[model samples]
Target: MSLHVTNTLSGEREPFEPHDPDSVLLYYCGLTVYDPAHLGHARAWVHVDVMHRWLEHLGYDVRHVENFTDVNEKIVAEIGEKGDSEASIAREMIGATLQDMRSLNLKRAEVYPRVSEHVPEIIDLIERLIDRGYAYESEGSVYFDVTAFEEYGKLSNQRLDEIESQGDPDERSEKRHPADFALWKAGEAHPEEGESGGQTWESPWSEGRPGWHVECSAMSMTHLDESIDVHVGGQDLVFPHHENEIAQSEAATGEEFAKYWLHVRLLETGGEKMSSSLGNYFYVEDVVDAVGTDVVRMFLLSTAYNSRQAYGEDALEEATERWERLERAYERATAAIDGPDAATKVEDAELRETIEDAREAFVEGMNDDFNTREALAALLSIATAINRHLDAREAFDYRGLRRAVETLEELGGDVLGFSFGRADDADGRVELAGDLVDLLLEVREREREAGNYDRADALRDDLEALGVTVEDDAEGTSYRL
Candidate 1:
C-alpha cells in the first residue's frame, strides 16, 4: 500500500517510482471525435480523475494532458455527404465529449491538444523518424518501418514474426514488412476518389493526414514532455494502438516513452465490452440524466480501475443503494453535530477511534494501486459507526463528528470523486441485502463447522468492513445494520 501501482509494462504491483520526485507527468488517451462518449469512457475518466487528485493531494505539480483525435477517418464517416466538413463534425462530437466530461465532474487537464492543432509537430516527428532511418516514404506518404525499431513490440510483448499487418491491405505492397504502420497517409491523388481530398494538408510527403497512432505521440510530446511519468488508456488499446505508440515515440526521441503504462480494463455488459460499433454502450449523458452523476461516479468507483466492471440494471441499483447508505450516514452526522442534543462535555472515544481507523484504511487502500473497492469498504465502516453513535447516544461528540465528516469529504468525496449528501432516502436501498447477508452467514456457518475459524473470522471481518455487524448468539447468527 506504499504508493504502489499495477504497471502494465512490468506486470507487477511495484512502488510508484516517479520520474521526477516532485511531480507527475500524466497523459490519458482521449476520445476520437466520431461519437458521443459512453459509460466505458466514463470509467476511464473517473479513474484518471482519481489518479490526478491523489497525485495533487500528494503535493505534486501534476501536468496532465488529454488528447482529442479530431482528424480521424471516423469523423469523415460521420460527415457522410451531409455537406458537413470533417472539421465541423469533429467540433460537434468534441463538444459532446466535453459535455460528458463536465457532467462527470472530471477535472480539466492542463491541456487538451488535438491532432489537427499538432499537425506541424506530427510532420516534424515523421521527418525525424525518416531521418533516423526508422521510417520510409511510399508514393506520397510515409510509414514507420517497424522492423527498424529493434524494440518494436516490447510494450505488447509481441514479436515481429507473430505480428500481422499494421495497416490496410493495400499498404502491404508499400510496406517492407507486414507490421509496418503508416506515419502519414497520402490524400487521393485523384479528386474524384474522395470528397475530402481538399482537406489534406501540404506536407513534405504530400497532402495527407496523420495516422491514428502518430497523432497521439505527436500530441503527447508537444503538450507533455518527450518522456512522461505515466501514460494511461483502456486495455483494449494495448495491442496495436499502444504498441505502435511506443515504437514510434521511442524511435523518434531515443528515450523511454513512458515510465509506467496504466491501462484501465474494459467495462462490459453481458460479457461483451461496451462498444459503439457493437451498439452495446450507454451514452454518458443519458446515464447521468437517469441516475445522476454522483451515483454513476460511485458505481464506477465501486470497482477498481484495473478490474473489469459489469454495467447493468443490478450494478446501477447497487450503486444507488450504496450511495444512499453513505449519504444518509453523512447527513445524520452533520445533523447530530449541530442538533440541540449535541453537548461539548460528550466524548466518544470508540467512535473517534473508528473514524481515525477508517481514515487510515482508506489511505492504505488508495495507495494499494488505487483500490477504491477497499477504500469504499473503509469509508462504509465509518458510516456504520456514525449511525451507531447517532442511533444510540443522546449527545454527540461535536469535534469527533466534525473530523469524521471532514474525513468523508476529503477521502470519499475528494479522492474517490463521489459527491455525497444528495439527501436521498432509503427507499432505493438494496431490497435483497438481507438475503445476501443470510447467504454470507450460511457460508460462514459452514466454514466454522469445518473448523476453519480463520476463514469464518475473515468473513466476519469483511462483513464488518462493509457496515454489517454479524453476531453469533445461542440459537443462530444474526446481523445488524
Candidate 2:
C-alpha cells in the first residue's frame, strides 16, 4: 500500500515516497531537557511512534532518529538554579525523559543524538553556511541571513515580511533583516558581562552556545543524512524551529532537505493550545496511571495526525469505552473459536465481504495520511458486525473472526500501541485461576454471611494456593493478582 502524509511544505496530502525503498530515514524533533515532558510532548511523540509503526507494518525499514537538546539556554538557567554542573543536570533530566518515554511503550530511537555531544558538527555546519554567504557573524555571534535563503518560510508557510514585523533582536542587532535568527550567541567567561550569565563555550568569536534550531539541523543531518524521508514535529514548531532547520540544513548540504515534512496538530484545552509554559499541561504517566496504558494509547491515536484534538475527561472516557468494546469483541471471537473441523461456515457471504471491506478501508484510511480517526471508525464498524453476529448467536465463519483479530493486532497493538490482551493473559494460568478464585470468593462471602467460618477459611486457603490475595471487610471480599 502507498503511504500518504500531509506534507507541511505544500499544506496538502500527497503519496509519501521515500528516497530509499529498502530503508526509510525519519527524524523527529525531540525534547529539550529544561523540564519534564507534558501531554503536548507525548501527543507529538505518539504521533511519530504510530507513524513509524505503520510504515514498518507496510514493509518499510525505518531508521528513526530523535535528538535531545541537552545544551540549550534553558538547560543552563535550570542548572544554575540548582547549583549543579550543567552536564550533571542535563544528564539527569535526559535520563528521566527516557524513562517517561519507556512508560509510553515508545522504543528508544535507532539514534538519539545529543546536541552537547555534537557541538563540533553544529560548528561545521555553521562554518559551511558562513562560507556559502547564507550566514554571517555579527557582534561575535553567527546569524542565518533569512534573505539569503529565498524559500526561508516555505515549511511554516509564513511570509518573511510578516515574521519580520514581530521584530525580536538577537546579537545581530545590525542585521539588515529583523527576521534573521541566531545560529550562535556570543557570551563572556564570567557571569557579570551582561551577556549569557557565564554559560559560555569557546567558539570562533566568543564563548556561548548554539541556538535551539541549530541543534536539530546538525544532529539530524549527521544521523539521518542530509536529505531525510520525513521530518515530524508538533504544529507549533512549524515556525522558526523547523523553518530555520530547513534554511541551515539545505544551505549547508546544497540538497533538498526532507522530502516530506509532517506536523502533528497540537492538543488543546478549553479551546486554547496546551503548553507546558502555560502551566496547563498533563503528563503521560498521570493518564496511564489513572486509566491503563491502552486507553491512553487509544486516546492519542483516535484523532487524525494533522487535525487538532481537544483532550479532556470526556475524550478519555470515550477512549476507554471504545477500547472495552473492541476488547470484548475480540474476547467473544476467541470464545467462539472451535477446531478447524467444527468451524461454522458463514452463510451470508455479503456479511463476510463487509468484514473484508472494513479491513481494506482501515488500511486505506491509514495509508492516506495516517488518518487514524477514519481507520478507527472502520474498526468500530467491524465491531458492530461482530456484535450483530454475537446477538444472533448464528454459526458464523471463523475466518472473519480470524481476520478481525489480525486487523486489531496490527492496527491496535502495533500501530496504535494499544495492549489489547487482558492482564490475565500475561501469565498462562491466571485466566482460569483468576476466574475460579473469584467464584470461590463469592462462595466464601455467602458462607461468611451464614456464619460458616470453617468452609470460608478452607476456600480462602484454596485461593491462597493459587496466588490470589483476598481482603475481607464488613462490605464483602475482594481479590488481587
Tens digit of lDDT per residue, candidate 2, span 1-481?
Answer: 6777878898787888898987899999988887778778888888789888888988999999999887765666664564365567677667667767877878568989988888888888899999999998888778888999988889877778888532244343556678788888776333233433424577885677787788899999898799999999888888878888999999988899899999888999888888877878887667766887677777888898788799899999999999889888877766665444215556545546767888788899889888888888888777777777767755666776777677777777777777666555644565777787778778897898899999989988887665566777788678754
C-alpha lDDT of all candidate models, in order: 0.86, 0.79
Q: Report model 2's TM-score to 2 decimal places.
A: 0.82
lDDT of 1 by residue, 1-481 (tens): 5699988887888898788899999999999877889999999999999999988877888999999998877677665553367788787677668768978878899989888888899999999999999999998879899889988788888789999787779888888888889899897322234555325688997888888999999988888889999999999999899999999999999999999999999999879999988999999989988988879988999999999799999999999998888888898998987788878888899899999999888889889988889989999999999998888888888888888899888988877777766424432453467778889899999999999999999999999777676777799788754
Best candidate according to lDDT: 1
> Model 1: how far is 195 from its true place, Å?
4.8
| Local error of candidate 1 at residue 478 (angstroms) | 55
What are the TM-scores, per candidate, against the unseen true structure? 0.86, 0.82
RMSD for all candidates, in order, please: 17.8, 10.5
